[model samples]
Target: MFCVSENLYLRDVKLSDSSIVAKWKNDPLIRELSIGLDTKITNENQESDIKKSIESKQPYYIISLKDSDRPIGYIRLNWMDNSERFGWLRFGLGEERGKGYSKEALSSFLQKVFSNDTHRIDAEVYAFNKISLNLLKSLGFIHEGTRRNAYYTKGSFFDVYTLGLLKGEFNYIKRDDK
Candidate 1:
């Protein structure tokens, strides 16, 4: 899958991206914010996971700058049911955390997915990750509920907030020149 916005674009993940992806996965700050296991991942393991994800035809994408084509992050949709319409979103950025890249990338990605018959998207963010929570809300995602003490990390448990966005609630407008 490929998606283009004004400043960024997203393309399918490739095997060559494993090394950088491993770096992001092992980053301390990234691990703290993510809901996945905190165990460190080796490049080989990341490569294997990428291969399997590709073979399974999952919507895993690498977010990059259009001008430099430099990969800064990744976003993926994991389907929740057999209908393939409802998906759970997971994303992370490397060194480009505060550059507004995520918003553009996610906007483009969401537009593409919604246009492709996706009915809804859900995201679970750690309560401590206020940036992601605000970002999702800015994109029209509504706060569904909170899972109390659902994620244990950094020697403490944190609440997890569930957010959902239906296709009808998305207010993005696609520009032709992008």
Candidate 2:
């Protein structure tokens, strides 16, 4: 699958993107925000995971710039329900965190997913992650509920907010190509 936004595109994740994912996974800051906070990942492990993703019929894409095919991050639809209409979203950006690429990429991905069989999309964000919380809210993701102290790390716990967006609630914004 391929989704084009102004300057970035969400394309099929390739085996070559494993190293970039491994680098991000190994970063302390990135790891702290992710579910696998305590788990250390190696390039080999990332490669194996990529292979599994390639083999599975899941929606996974690498966020890449139009000017360059190299991936700066990735987004995936995960934890799909038995009904196949709902799924959770997980994404990570390496050195391109502050850029608007993620916002565009997510918009494109959501549009693509909702245009098909998917009805609802869920995102679990740590309470301390203000950026993600703001992003989700701005994207029209309703704050459904919170799992208090759901994430434990370094002798402390953090709440996790479960944000959800239904297909009807999504507002697809087009970039003014002027």
Candidate 3:
């Protein structure tokens, strides 16, 4: 079950979500930056992926516009190594890029995640993906560093830059958000 606020919503992904998910995944602009865009999704593929998330209790949810109920994206916190005290945040908003929604969607998503007592949140982005980097940085995520040639994409290996936001940072932003 997803707990959504009045302005943003997160819902348990349904099988019915496949068509849109497929469309989003296949979009060239989105695929060039996504983590799983290279893979083709069949019915079994979707079920298996969702099952894996469920089994590990990954916090996966579809994000949607509040007023129109139009699904826009999905965000998740995963690979939570107990000793690390943080989880990786990954999201792809598909063709819905540049509408000023990522910030709001992300702010709400972080609000939900940090509410659970996590120490920090981190994201590793391909250095070339300026859009994603900007979104994270605008939300106060700091540039930790980059791993040269870390990701294989678009017929080339890409450097991945890591960014992070501390719990206190999130709190400070929220407190000042008003």
Every candidate's lDDT: 0.88, 0.83, 0.75
Total clashing residue pairs per candidate?
A: 0, 0, 0
Query: What ranges in model 1 sit over 4 Å off?
Result: 35-37, 173-178
Better of 2 and 3 by TM-score: 2
Please state the error at residue 34 of candidate 2 in Å.
1.9
Error of 2 at 78 (Å): 1.7
Error of 1 at 1 (Å): 6.0
Task: Name model 2 segments beyond 4 Å from true.
Answer: 176-178
Between candidates 1 and 3, the TM-score winner? 1
What tens digits encode model 2's per-residue C-alpha lDDT throughout 1-178? 4788888888888788788889987888788887557888888999998888788767778988888876788898874776669998998888887877777788888888888889999999999888888877767799999999988988998999999999999867668421
- Cα-based lDDT at residue 92, candidate 2: 83
Q: Taking the tens digit of each residue's C-alpha lDDT, what string does model 1 give over 33-62?
A: 883566888999999999998987778999
Q: Worst ten-residue run, lDDT, model 3?
A: 169-178
Pairs with steric clashes in candidate 1: none
Put down candidate 3 lDDT per residue, 14-125, tens digits, no spaces.
Answer: 6577667767766777777765458665666666677778787777788887888889988878856865468999877866677666677678778767677788899988
- Candidate 1: residue 165 lDDT (0-100): 98
Candidate order, TM-score descending = 1, 2, 3
TM-scores of all models? 0.92, 0.91, 0.83
